[model samples]
Target: MDDATVTAPAPDEDIDLAYDVFARSCPSRHTLEHVTGRWGALTLGALSENTLRFNELRRRVDGVSEKMLSQTLHALERDGLVHREDRQTNPPRVEYRLTPLGESVAERLLSLIELIEGKMPEVLAAQHRYDGRRPA
Candidate 1:
């Protein structure tokens, strides 16, 4: 099928959408994975604050290898979540920033990150309890 149109019942109404993320074949799943993956999430979060060049972004993301960051940037750029600007300068300068859609995604992702960070104490306690039950 060229597109998948599914009718989902909402709390107040019936909604018709062209794509369903829950469906296995939906393209949104890949996009979601890219946005939520460790490196991708960190990259988006870092860019959420400022536009950065390659090395600067690499440094900001901390542990990401050069190749991985390059690949991540390329994927995000292809997904329309990132904008890459190439400037004709003495040595040439390239910078990456979020597109409008990316800003929206990053804003939501940051909220999720903040929530996870804030709940770490409780999460750690739960982890301790769970691990206590495991065999040595």
Candidate 2:
């Protein structure tokens, strides 16, 4: 990921995308924010496969608060990583999908997911070792 970026959100100023995560402040931080947030990465990864309604998204992603999910969607939408569509239908149909940019990030995240899953046992062991309890 030579091109990943990072940055802090400023309420009133234009974001200066570092365009490099290692940069002091990557302008692409917005995308990273979406990918690593409580509901962001999951949402983007889920949507990468196909579009889904709010409920569907909720079902696919576990352990996310409604408020957090909503916030994540809004942020991703603002950053152009996600697309929100409101349709005229019974109770109104709203679906979330990822933009091409988000898809790129999702592809990267997929590998990350694999890496994390592969190392889960080791991670848990490490955590347990430092969890303040003696090892059995």
Candidate 3:
């Protein structure tokens, strides 16, 4: 569909304001999965810096195969969180960047990642203690 036809989910109708993600049919669950999936998070994080070409993004994300990256980008693009620009040129250059909404989400993800990294030592220690209690 064209850009004009694309629309965000309506606040009042389609997505219930009181929807619980724990429920099987909640639309938020699908959105959460798309935004927080391994490649999705990384892709958003990488694009938070600036626009990047396909290969540049692939390299930045590290270990994500081309197919997976493409899929992640497509999902983000469909969600209106990522902008894909095609520069008409001899070689068909394309670049990806986070939309404003995407930047907001990416910033949140970066903060969460930082918090996890800061607590990793404590988490690892807890894991070690838990593992120790298990019978061999």
Candidate 4:
């Protein structure tokens, strides 16, 4: 099946999509996953604040293994959400920052993060209640 010719989930109207994240076979789903995965989300959030080197990003995200961070950055870079710049100095200097599209995505993601943080008390209470009801 040609994903580019696939129709989106419009109830009453037919809309052909080049790529629909909702479609199971759509390539957009992979990009969406890359942007929203644990390490990917953290890395994007950190870079949204300032451009960073590889080590700096890993430090900012915390708890991410070196291999995981490397993989996450590569995926983000490939998705055009992260821009990597390498400067040719005596010792090579590399930096990572959000692209324009990445900035937009990060802005939305930060809003979600803020909402989650603000609702943590409620979330914790819910978790406690849920745990109390569950058998260990």
Tell me the TM-score of each prediction against the true structure. Answer: 0.87, 0.74, 0.83, 0.86
Clashes of 2: 7
Decoy 3 TM-score against native: 0.83
Top of the candidates by TM-score: 1
Ranking by TM-score: 1, 4, 3, 2
What tens digits encode model 4's per-residue C-alpha lDDT throughout 1-136?
4444443474677766466567777777888899889999999999999999999988999999999999999999998999999999979999999999999999999999999999999999999999999999
Query: Which residue pairs come into collision in candidate 3?
Result: none
Candidate 2 or 4, higher TM-score? 4
Model 1: residues with Cα > 4 Å off, grouped in runs = 1-17
Q: Each model's C-alpha lDDT?
A: 0.91, 0.82, 0.88, 0.90
Give the clashing residue pairs of candidate 4, or none.
none
**Whose lDDT is greatest here?**
1
In angstroms, how far off is 118's CA in candidate 4? Answer: 0.7
Q: What is the lDDT of residue 34 in candidate 4?
A: 95
Summed backbone clashes in each candidate are 0, 7, 0, 0
List where candidate 2 sits over 4 angstroms from the true fold.
1-26, 132-136
Show the lowest summed lDDT stretch of 10 residues, model 4.
1-10
